[model samples]
Target: MPSLRSIRSRIRSVKNTRQITKAMEMVASAKMRKAQQRVLDTRPYAEKIYELMHRIASREKAWSSPFFETRPVQTIGVLLVSTDRGLCGAINANLFRSLVRFMKERPGVRFEFVTIGRKGRDFIRRSGFNLTGVIQGVKDRGTIEEILPATQLVIEEFSEKKNWQEAWIFYTQFESIMSQKPRHEKLLPIDPEVLTGSGNPPNGHSGEYLYEPDRRDILDVLIPRYFETVIFQRVLENFASEYSARMVAMKNATANAKEVIYGLTLTYNKLRQANITKEISEISSGAEAISQG
Candidate 1:
């Protein structure tokens, strides 16, 4: 058993830690609510754009868009999305693991990375993976205009340089407060079935489609918008995932700190009681001895 002073010190330290974790938890919760709302607001737009793109890509008529083109796999581009800061549980770890597995599955393909967050950039740089591009300091709830440069970089890398045949993005999907799943998705050549999912609504029929200038002109506009929308949606989702994971992690830390304080308090009480009992016994013994003397 330790001294009362030592136990009290530990209790005080833990109390301070608990207070810090509790405050962090509250901040994360507030950020999570905003991120969640943004995600929900954009889902409809994302789904519709994906549906429209899927219908066009799935047709046998054969669109000549480079985005839909399938080429020989020699080089692979990866867009790794991670939080700029830590204390977000294993959200980024899950993404890294998925990327590792993907690399293992496809041996001999040269992989280059475009990292959105500082963490991903550091990881890629440290791991000796070729870093083609990096865009950091992307704010939460960032606008499409702000995110467009990174999108353009990836697109140009694929189209202009033709260095990468296929590209994928890794992010954590915010399913719920307690549940965030790491998502690994192919960004290009776009997968048709993934876009359509279970198919579109009744109004999504080809007959309802109308071209303002021409079909080709519509596609030219739609393709870039598709990329922008998808990237923006993922960014928002990662924000929600980051905050949710942080909130849960901080909540756990606070709870564990409280438990530690409770245990220490219990031990301190026992030790103090034992000391008081010993003092009373000593006093009683002394009184009896003096009386006898």
Candidate 2:
């Protein structure tokens, strides 16, 4: 049993913590909404480009682009998108776990990493993996230009055949406010099946289209744009997931702090009542003794 003074101090501390957590929860909620809207706005464009790219690649098999060339598996390039900050529940941990699982699945394969956030960079560095590129301190509402460097790094490495046969991206896909799943997708080799596998296009039609110049010419431009759009969209999805996870984590923290405050208040009241009762008893005993004397 803590003293009344100590219990009062604890209650005050918990109340202060609750206030901070509540404030963080509100901030995260607002950011999450904006991030969600950004993802929603970009998803259609991403899907349409993907469908167009798939259509082109499937039709133009005779075209020879470096992006569609498949080479022997030797070294793999991985772009990991993570949150810059912490307190986002198990989101970062889940991504790391997914990375570990990936490594386990492909044993003895060398992985070159390009990290988009401080957390992923630190993880890659601490794990002693080959970190080829890093892009940190991206804003909450980051632009595509902010991620262009990493995207280019992956593109140049893969296209130039710099020991990178396959390129992949790991990110948290924002399914809903309560659910964010850690996912990875193969970025290079321009797999038309994988592109079309992600469901129908924005118009809900996957029919063939007429290219203006030629299929090869369109692919030469569309392939790179498709890569950039996919990477940018993954970053946006990661942003939404980060905010959603943070908002939920802060909400839980705020609730736990409130519970602590409530418990501490109850203890404080009990101790104060006990102290008052003891003091009254002592006063009555002293008065009785003085009267007898």
What is the Å distance of residue 240 in model 1 from its true position? Answer: 0.5
> Which portions of model 2 show Cα errors greater than 4 Å?
195-210
The count of residue-pair clashes in candidate 1 stands at: 0
lDDT of 1 by residue, 60-110 (tens): 236666787888999999888889999989999888888899999999999
User: What is candidate 2's lDDT per residue for 67-123, written digit by digit as tens?
Assistant: 776778789899999989999999999999999999889988899999998899999
* RMSD for each of the candidates: 2.4, 2.6
Candidate 2: residue 46 Cα off by (Å): 0.8
TM-score of each: 0.92, 0.92
Q: Lowest lDDT 10-mer window, candidate 2?
A: 199-208
Q: After aligning candidate 1 to the native by TM-score, how far in Å is the CA of 227 from where it should be? A: 1.2
